[model samples]
Target: MSSPAPPSGAAPTPSLLRPWPQFLDLSALSLPISLSEATYRLTQNLRYFLPNYVVITLLIFLVTLVSRPLSLILFLCIFAAWIYLVFLRDEPLTILDYDIDQKIILGLLAVMTLVALLWTKVWLKLLISLIIGAVIVLIHGILRAPEDSMEDSPYGSLLNVVDSPGGEHASV
Candidate 1:
């Protein structure tokens, strides 16, 4: 039976994800016909949906690390320490009234990384897990339908993440 159409004032369909609908548009997923087509789709989709891709990769990385509590904890600690100390900190780090140099912090990070590798099998697992994440992201980027203009892409109109040409995203 033919159903009646909705009123003109009706709202549009809700997104699969409220913040980003295009992130999981199963209807639009497809395989590229050729290498050049795949490359074009990948480049365009990566620029158009980079934030979604990053979130997916991070979720996969964290989920994989969950099976290894020690590795997860150690990795998080090292990452958090580096972020807070090097990027977010407004004041110099000090120990025993001695100002710590950035070089020293980097050295400590390298030593800690070596210890993490030597004392555990984290190196292999970490490499495999992250590579899996990146592969998944790359696959998504290549499979999603290509957008000729990133600014006119679905999410592009909803969010200003991708600025118009000659704007903040100058490269785009």
Candidate 2:
């Protein structure tokens, strides 16, 4: 036998397990053509966007905290390599050499941060990493004297030679 239909004019009941609608129907979401319209839409969505922005900011802060130790270790390793190259390796020095090394370290730290965010939840790990990074930078800055200074600089010998009259005459 066929079941009787609900009475006319009554709303249909949604599924008990899934009370919300299935579709967001955002296919009509399009970029606004005019500046005024864009501003209006942005203002209208501020309530929705604000909470999401706050959540994202909090997550980023937590991730930075968690991944700080790894960042510090990477920084220290890079800093050690720099010192070795500049002081002991007898390598020819150039401004770009240090710049390139620093960039590589930063890139590695970024990757480590991303990995930490994905794999870990411990805040202690991140805090340690951050502390390590800060220490490495501080130490490196203190040890790595400026190259341009004529006196008491890492490149002082080279500068002295260049500044001496005999050296300039010899070069001419």
Candidate 3:
């Protein structure tokens, strides 16, 4: 049999599972008048209040300082700077438009190239490793077939590095 309703002027018991009935209301939000406003507020806060570029640079610097040797700190710092510049800062003059995946691959290739150049005892091996890194980078670009593929020159940059007698200025 069904139970009787609550007595007059008496409040009904609240459910434990569905506590905080006001949580369902959309108008109860205090911050962010709208979606665009929220985004603008966050961006503005970061731009004015937070010094992200300096923080990343300082972290990298500290990591490099406390470490025993400067083997990978330089690479780490460059990678961190790349991340901050690519994702956070909106300065078009100092920004790079490369995709995140492409940037990661390029960063790895850069680290490998640097290591190969430094750790190698002979010049020929370093050259070979640099060429291999370049080939891998190019292959990634071809496989992905990105919108910026045309910007990357196949025979120009790759060939210049592969054919250069000495380890020239190869910015991968």
Candidate 4:
């Protein structure tokens, strides 16, 4: 037997359990536009603020080169930058700046992770994590750059591209 048709001008009944529309919306979390925007903004900042990257890298290297207090200070600096970008930035969450400063902090964690692998030194893991994070950022930067663009940026080298609106190098 076939089900009865709905009455004229009456809405159709929705499933008592899960509804199709709700399910589709929930499953759309992996949308590409959001991911690509995130990639663009992230690489933009990383390519722009490479000194911050170097500073963090050197700091981690120093941690390996020196003692504990210096490492903590360097890590704190990295963390402070992250708070600024993630909390204070006006851009939409999906398209916020790439902010490699935070990655530097994570890289330190990676370093610590690396050390942990060789030994039980928890601090060393920071360095290991830092290295891995750097590799990821580098890959993202390369992928984000346009193929036919000559001279990535006028301000700095190919790796760093801080371009001003008037066609000049703004700053590093």
Using TM-score as the measure, which candidate wins? 1
Kindly list the per-residue Cα lDDT of model 1 for residues 10-49, writing each as its tens digit.
Answer: 8533211224665777877887666866777788776666
Model 3: pairs clashing at backbone N, Cα or C within 3 Å = none
TM-score of each: 0.50, 0.24, 0.22, 0.25
lDDT of each: 0.68, 0.44, 0.42, 0.46
- Predicted candidate 2 versus true structure: per-residue lDDT over 2-43, tens digit per residue: 446879986434211111121112442454435544444444
lDDT of 4 by residue, 98-124 (tens): 534545655665675454334534355
Could you give the C-alpha RMSD of every candidate to the true structure, in order shown? 15.4, 31.6, 28.3, 21.1
User: Which prediction has more favorable lDDT, 1 or 4?
Assistant: 1
lDDT of 2 at 73: 55
* lDDT (tens digit, per residue) of candidate 3 on 1-172: 3357779997433211122233223343334434544444444333332333234333443454343345345545555755555544333422285434545655775776466446633344334544654454333222322222224433335545667777476488
List residue ranges in candidate 4 displaced over 4 A: 1-33, 67-172
Worst 10 residues of 3 by lDDT: 14-23
Q: In every candidate, how many clashes are there?
A: 0, 5, 0, 24
> Which is superior by TM-score, 1 or 2?
1
